[model samples]
Target: MGEERECCHHRTKERSEKEYKDMINRLSRIEGQVRGIKGMVEKNAYCPDILIQVAAVTAALNSFNRVLLANHIKTCVTEDIREGREETVDELLATLQKLMK
Candidate 1:
């Protein structure tokens, strides 16, 4: 009943400490990988080797996205839906579409 009311401001997520730490660790690793690639370039490493490192970074980012998406679906989306916010589902779909692209 009260769910039908309009929201004047955007919602925010409150992540658990574990989730936050996990994401931070993942990003730190990715950052390290990027720095390593830069070092390789500085030393004139083989193109193929540098490409492999870049691929590894890509995989790490994808893994991060998967974890984040799962958390979003479980927490934010679930709560929004329970509160009668069907629009959140559409927003989720759009975000997924962008991620896939």
Candidate 2:
């Protein structure tokens, strides 16, 4: 999808086919990891084992975030700035603040 400005202030960013597929694949793996964690809980697996799995999932999510952030900076942020959309920078800063928190 191309950039969409919704009436309710929600925005959408279109991704290239490769980017979209990569994101979807990463999400599917994360979903599987979560389901595995739930299974571990149901099976009464060792606490340490569960914690390790959780950490793996957290790292995977962080990696995904890093990739997505890089893509956004390279594309959306760069394009917006080139087009004289100063507000995009402020929006990015606000997003970064929230991510950091």
Candidate 3:
């Protein structure tokens, strides 16, 4: 259940155990944060307090994106470029644009 971009032309990279664990850990933390936010809403917590927690979750998600993007660029992008697959660069750019939005 890794987050590889499902494409017919692309290949999947097998992440190192450490990398996999780190991503899983980050996702777990984010999941917990979401649950906390749900609890806060259920208990009628203050708006500002709930917003703060929501911001934290967004920050955590951004961090996860950064880590995943860095790894993708380092491994998948590099390999594709080496293999003369110019389309991968376009795909990467498109992905980055979406992320920026």
Model number with the top lDDT: 3
Tell me model 2's lDDT, rounded to 2 decimals.
Answer: 0.85
Q: Give the per-residue lDDT digits (tens) of candidate 1, residues 1-101.
A: 45442332176555667877999999999999999999999999999999999999999999999988887887778878888988989999999999988
List the candidate 2 regions with Cα displacement exceeding 4 Å: 1-10
State each model's C-alpha RMSD to the native: 5.1, 3.8, 4.6
Would you estimate the TM-scores of all the predictions? Answer: 0.88, 0.88, 0.89
Ranking by TM-score: 3, 2, 1
Candidate 1 pairs with clashing backbones: none
In candidate 3, stretches whose alpha carbon ends up further than 4 angstroms from where it belongs are 1-11
Q: Kindly list the per-residue Cα lDDT of model 3 for residues 26-86, writing each as its tens digit.
A: 9999999999999999999999999999999999999999999988888788877877888
Per-residue lDDT tens digits for candidate 2, residues 1-101, read 77642111136776778888999999999999999999999999999999999999999999999998888888778877777787888998998999899
Task: Evaluate candidate 3 by giving its C-alpha RMSD to the native, one decimal.
Answer: 4.6
Worst 10 residues of 1 by lDDT: 1-10
